[model samples]
Target: MPLSIYNTLNRRLEPLRPRDPKRVTFYTCGPTVYDDAHIGNFRSFLAADVLRRFIESPLCELEGSGPGPRSVVHVMNITDVGHMTDDDQADGGGEDKMAVAGRRLLEQKKSGKLPPGVELDPNSPYDIARFYTMRFLDDAKKLGLKVAIEHDKDASLMPRATANVPGMIALIGKLIERGHAYVVGPAGARVVYFHVPSFEGYGALSGNTLDALREGAGGRVGTENQSGKKHPADFLLWKEDSTHIMKWDSPWGAGYPGWHIECSVMSAARLCGSGSVLSPAQLVQMQVPDAQPIIDIHSGGEDNIFPHHECEIAQSCCAFNASHSGPYAGMWFHPRFLFVEGAKMSKSKGNFFTARQLYLPAPEGKGIAPAAIRLELIRTHYRSNANFTEQGLKDSARMVERWRRFMDTAGKGSTSSDAAARGACREAIAAAMHDDLNIAGVLGELNGWLGRVDAPGPEDAELLREIDAVLGVLELEQAKSAQTDIGVFIGCEADPAVLAKLNERVEAKKAKDFARSDAIRNDLAAMGYQIKDVAGGKVEVRRG
Candidate 1:
């Protein structure tokens, strides 16, 4: 079966297609690097990771050609600038989020809360952005979300918003030249706005009419009214202000680009190739040509469906291909929210938690595994809001442990790979994945198959390997060793020192030396070893 997905643009299931049959350009809206990313934010990224895996899998073969690393390019932008708090559509309405975080650090320094030599400048947005960007990427690494990290030559491309400011300025100029944008307000305080009425399909993506969006603007309508906006809903393209330290010199004045422009510009520059040093006439014609789609798929959370994504479509279309009457992205995918304890996560409600918080033991007793976290998130359908609970974590851990044991047992028998066999279980898994990523169904099928296994046959072994290509939660290779630990128990290999202790413990037990054996157990526990007594006067030593 061919791969199909629920495209949010047209609100229907569509067959996957790329402008170039050999390659696919995938773009995902990344996090604003101002704070630690919460679990809710990671949910959307998890969906993107799953989608990329499925797309690159052999099961996604189209006619005869198969998608692979060279065929698919996953681009996730890092919003290190222009993102602001109090912005409904994530456009710059209030203060820059990085600047706000920097101010907090400044306050902390004044209160003497900083570590000795740690100095922070409140005016430097880069300092705050760097701090949280590292945190966010570290969290992504811990959670095993697939993305390019540091200097790794990975499949995904991560471009920063600040790095593409020149491209943003050029795109804004093109918008103004095309009569889709206008400059308003006074000289130094001038702000550029996208004329929403200029684009005929302004609200096509969100299905909100221009007049309806303007009517619902409420207090925000008059907020920019003093800026001389032609319409209440005209979103900001650039804001000219000298007080801001993050300002850049633009045609309009020395100011910063708006929040919506960042995504549009970055994606265009990275994926579609915006000319860096082209003349004004040359730049105007340097839009994404209609020969191929600029982006094959654009993925984000459901919250970005309106104004944020809608604005992207308008800005991209007006700046590049104003005559084209289609959405900027060929397909759109918006994963639903991830609720905690059946409620929307909020710090005020004491339910909001980061991936780091979720990685540790919640109540200080049972620790949550990162693999378990990955499993629980993937078990639910992406379109549905998955409710995260402690019980869910426990269940995932148990299931993962069971699968590991099965693979370990299977590993002892079959050491050969079946080069041409496609097992029934593997086929079912692929079919489920092909059908809009029914990962819940995939898990159900795999779990049911695993439960009936006393020992995996050759087919079962091959199936396990094949399934893991998409579901990367399994640790089969580690489980292959005889003394391999499956879950909380760590495995230990027999060494001279370990054998000496094991023999001593056995001798102590035979001599009815309970005190000596207990002392030995405590000593082993201190050294990260757990001793388990077994049948035939033998003992199992596992690393903790």
Candidate 2:
């Protein structure tokens, strides 16, 4: 009953082997901070969240029935700089995503679109980055990202790429001294490239050989960045660009680190570190040095498998332990892409959706609650593509409401469910989760169990609490104001005063104080609130 997962490195499903049972170090790529994260991007992050939740859960059955990882040292990086649009190359091609943000913000500023008191200097990419970074964090919180929730309390959990320039420069210098990287061009416009061919296991993760990359396989090995590279696949580590909007002083020149370098440096510094310095060279070392795994797992979208992650492997291997032949980390996980309405999401197609665009209630009375949005994004298996549609979102809302009612009902019960039945249900849910996060399977188990139970008991509530600890979609305390979008009517929390009165009425009914319940109803009517009891535990709160 050991937890198993598909490691993208060797293309094999294997057991999770964390060197330490107390603390499991995990890292996942965060938003680029140039724009709002689209639905597709969140699907990838949701996979990472689920993985962390399962890894830290006691339900994760491990080898010899030993105690599992007690805690997860999760680090998700905020790419406020150095990420490019065309990320397939080692030295990322195309425009800097932050620069694009700066330009857009400048235009908005000139048009007076930016709000007052929000003094945004479009010329300053740093200002633009912070703006979008905060917005992204807001969205991540609404979607229940644990790292995002604890980010304010622990800044180390989410490191910004711009803040780690020194670390990037240090790692690049190590690569150069180790002969894995070389500097080229003039002092005012110098460039550093990782000698991709120097690392023998360059294509072990992505299966893209140097031979194929040289021939422009998949058009990933771009001809634009061939000026100073030892090989076509030799990705850029540093580029001198004092003229750029966001430039940094580095060993190579006054420029910025490449997109691929940030993940390597941040992952090493944050996950396995010494406060301000990495004197012992943390996770830059081989996978397991003397039976110690500095970093456990790294994850991202499937699109990152290429030059982004591949180059990370080559550069980190060369910079940390030049002779070691292993992937950057011991394990790698990637989630599949997300589509909208059976097609790739595109603005022109009117199917694209940012997290906020769907989570916030719209003027047309169409919107998915935050928890429902989180549910929809993570309900499917990570390996499968989730096709988002309005119907699907509405279904998620109903599902959330259903779970809320179930939990509420369970809380009122004084007895326990059959012990064997409860154990079987928990086992089934855990088994589904251990199978590489079979979200669909786990949810199916939940629905089937809920349907069969006539009277939910105290044990059911405990079971739900355990399940929800991993799947954070159930906001048990939130009885959302019963929006008209979902087809069913249900009792929900309204204004504070109304909710308190309703609670009083429900309590009075439980105590058989019919007179008090009737008086509360009369009081609600006097307050211009129409209260009607519907069958099947649904109460309508129609405002007069």
Best by lDDT: 2
Runs in model 1 deviating more than 4 A are 62-70, 82-93, 106-123, 149-151, 154-156, 214-226, 274-284, 289-292, 322-324, 360-367, 415-422, 457-459, 475-544
- Model 1 agreement with the true structure over 171-230: per-residue lDDT tens digits: 888888888899987899888998888888877777777776657745355553344777
Cα RMSD for candidates in order: 5.8, 6.7
Residue-by-residue lDDT tens digits, candidate 2, 1-544: 7788899987988788876657778889888888889989998998899888888887887554477547888889999884543233443445666777788888888988765777777777788888888889988888889999889888888998888888788788878877888998988989888888788888888888787666663565666647767787677788887887778887677987887988888887877663333532543342434323346798999999986888887776666553644556778999999999999999999898898776654332234578777888899888888888778887987888888888889889888767888889899999998887888999999888887777788888888878988888884223235643211223223567877787788889889999999999999889866687766554577553
User: After superposing candidate 2, which stretches have Cα over 4 Å from the reference?
Assistant: 82-94, 107-117, 215-225, 274-294, 363-366, 476-544
lDDT of 2 at 302: 96
Strongest candidate by TM-score = 2
TM values, all candidates: 0.81, 0.84
